[model samples]
Target: MITTTSLKNNRTFIILFFFLLSFIGNAQIGIGTVTPNASAVLDITSTTQGMLAPRMTTAQRTAIASPADGLIVYDTDLKALYYYSSGSTSWVVVSSGINPRLNFKRIRSTDNLATVLATELAAGGGAKYVLNSNTLYEINGTVTFNFPIDLNNAYVHGLDSNDDIILRTSGNIFEGATGGSIRSLTIRAATGSVFNLNGAATQNLIFRDCIVANSASVGTISGFGLVFLSIINFSGNTNGITYNNISQLLLSNMGWFNNNAGTYEKLTGTFTLVEKQGGFSQVDGTAIGFDVSTSGLTITGDAVLESVVFTGTNTAGYVKGYTTGSYTGYNFNNSWNVRAAGIPTETDANAVGDFSMDYTVGSGLAVSFTNNLNPSNTVKVGSGTPLTTYSNLFRFSTDAANRLRYQGKKKRIFQIGGSISFQVPGAGTYIIYIAKNGTVISQYKIYGRGQILNDIVVLPLNATTELVNNDYIEVFAQRYTGANGDIVVPNMTITIK
Candidate 1:
């Protein structure tokens, strides 16, 4: 019914149409841009417009079959971003504020704390778990803290003011690789040492504002490192304990009491003790602040003690290299004893001392120093006698109420210095003298050419003098005759090392 020429022409036309359709279907498409990559199937470029990924619930995402490996979707139910992983056969999360290991299926049952912990740790995402409540979390069998875990509301009972918890077993309870934090918690050790890294050492453990207490000798505690930040109430352990390879002990209101002694080994870090209530003290044995059994114990920081008690045979030296400030809190009920043999040994060692002083001529006749002093150490000259007439030496007397009363039986070296500026109506002489217990130790005179002149004096006062308990250091300023001593005094400081 058809000629061969007509049939061939129709077949050629169909083949050409099919070829053109295939070319159009394979052509690259671009959005918001004129240029598109030759290899790309769809390319998008825009500053104002954003390309949104597929948003779906968890069930909808799981329902997707044979999804591409790099396919990303925002899970509306979980409010998280997830990417498909062919190897995992599921969606993988992009981020979690905490470690990915901690984002496992939470076990909310009221089962035993140990059981819940074990179940959560065994689940995928590393040895991580979250505690549901403020659990007492007693050890059922041998509990091992192998990986990083967070104890959301961990607490314990039967702890004293020292914050030392009682451990049931002395055998390494918290054993792990590193990186765990016990926050807003109280860990009561029933047996002995709470943190025992005996077999394998771990590092970077934090006890943030926590209470770690114990009884019957808190045992030897060793680890790669640990940090006790702010207000740790550590007590109990009578026989004392050893802290090995510890990084730091930030002591701000930290109390280490009732422990017979402490042997610090390989503490290559800073131990800052500033204004604490009760410090490393004990009732018996060689109470060593830190024995430094192995070298590399770099001690630093300052402390001002109202009272401190240390009794029995002393064998460890006090912390070296610390600055001392005004201290009214010294309650050393035990004999104030120091180690006989140790590095930087001393009988009663304290941090370096600090004192501040300021003086100005009284408008009401008395030429005296201001009462607003620091550390309450330096006693200012009272409103004794005003410099009404020039030649009156300003017979100044210390306001006995505010003197650095010596409590020790030995004398302390003081490096004293201050800057004095004064203006005289006529040529005059001004004398500045430092005295201890009504005895002049050092004095200097400055001659003013009827003009304002400033003088700075620094002198090492005493080498050794017995100022047995209840002596004071006094400073005096004398103005010569006919000189209108209008003094603008500032900058007076004393350093005792």
Candidate 2:
């Protein structure tokens, strides 16, 4: 009953239905190729042509409405790949390599540093920040930043009573923290250290022209890495510095100011090289000094410093055979370099606590006596009240002008060997006592007639002599006959060289 037109239409509908069925059964669409993956709804494969992502500037990308997670885009301005993050409701960089020119969120105060830092680091990118003020900013707790960020003129300080301001508990200030400087800031630690820098590996960490004053009883700076400190003033910490597992230490114009401890700093860890240069300090005579002890350390130049007194116990395990450097305005009481043995070796012979003897053939020699029994200056000798005290012997002049006094508070060695001539009015026994600093040490009894007796001589000083600084020798004469005697000191000299 159907016509030719109806038969033609039915055939067309059957062909179209078969085509739709074939499309739904495969469920694959391919471009530039006829075959596609069985599971893929749409696939594009090409060797010459690449897939083009949605490319736009940052502002244009941010203008996207309701961007789902996993939305990919290429930032023309950053020249990096970015994807939308649903948790943050923003676009984040796909890679961790940070470009220095990337704009960073400004942290004007410490109140917002944590929030801004967390956002930047979670974006998987680097940041650059600037601190506006040089005031004390209290950190609520430990702050751990993982990106390589630049701190340009960032001055973060803490109160003298706070535990810490910018603290890192476990990791470093930032991962890949290189080529960044912490300059021109004064940081103080109240209960803890200013920069813990502990339990982390910091590379190329620089403290340029910074001041760290830590009042904590433990340490000021403690860390392990390649550290460079230029023009840094560190003070007041119990232990000035404690570094472990160091690779290289570079110091330039650094001052370890007014700090006191048994050991100023301890480098018990390992290091390959240490280079220190251009530093000066003024130390307190009593409150400030340092004793350095390292496991194995090799110094390049002399560790000569001003106002810092080094002791023999310091520098115990350092290497030897280096040229001795000079310290200005301060005396080094300890050996600069340490030898294999523990004995301290002198660098200069004329240095402190050294004894030397010199001889010269010259005129202008003189002798001085304390109590010369002459007509003009007479000293009577008897068992009386006033004249019973000991009198010092004549001093011999060694130099041409006798300007250098080796006895009486001056540092020198002494060998008391001299004779004193005496005349007795009647035959009696004259007792001459040798005394050092008003204390009787030895005596000699001389039997004399009415003539002049020149047998009164002092014995040689032995090793048992406890000669203190500025001690003078004296001799006391007494007559047993209860009569006055004339004590004449003839030509005799006590060698004090």
**Among these predicted structures, which one has the highest lDDT?**
2
Q: Each candidate: what lDDT?
A: 0.42, 0.43
* Window of ten residues with lowest summed lDDT in model 2: 396-405
Which residue segments of model 1 deviate by more than 4 Å?
1-110, 119-167, 183-192, 197-204, 208-226, 238-248, 257-282, 285-296, 300-497
Clashes of 1: 34
lDDT of 2 by residue, 1-497 (tens): 99999999999999999977977998878887777777788889899999889899666787999999989999875567888889877677877634323343223334444465554344444343322223222233333332233332233333321343343232224222223445555544445444444434554456666555654533423344567778767666554555555566666776655453323444544554554555543344242333233434433333332222233333431212222222322222222322212223333222222111212322111222234232112122211221111122122211211111222222344444434444344344444444555554543323333433333322232212334444544444444442344444322222333
Q: Can you give the TM-score per candidate against the true fold? A: 0.33, 0.33
Each candidate structure's count of clashing pairs: 34, 2
lDDT of 2 at 93: 83
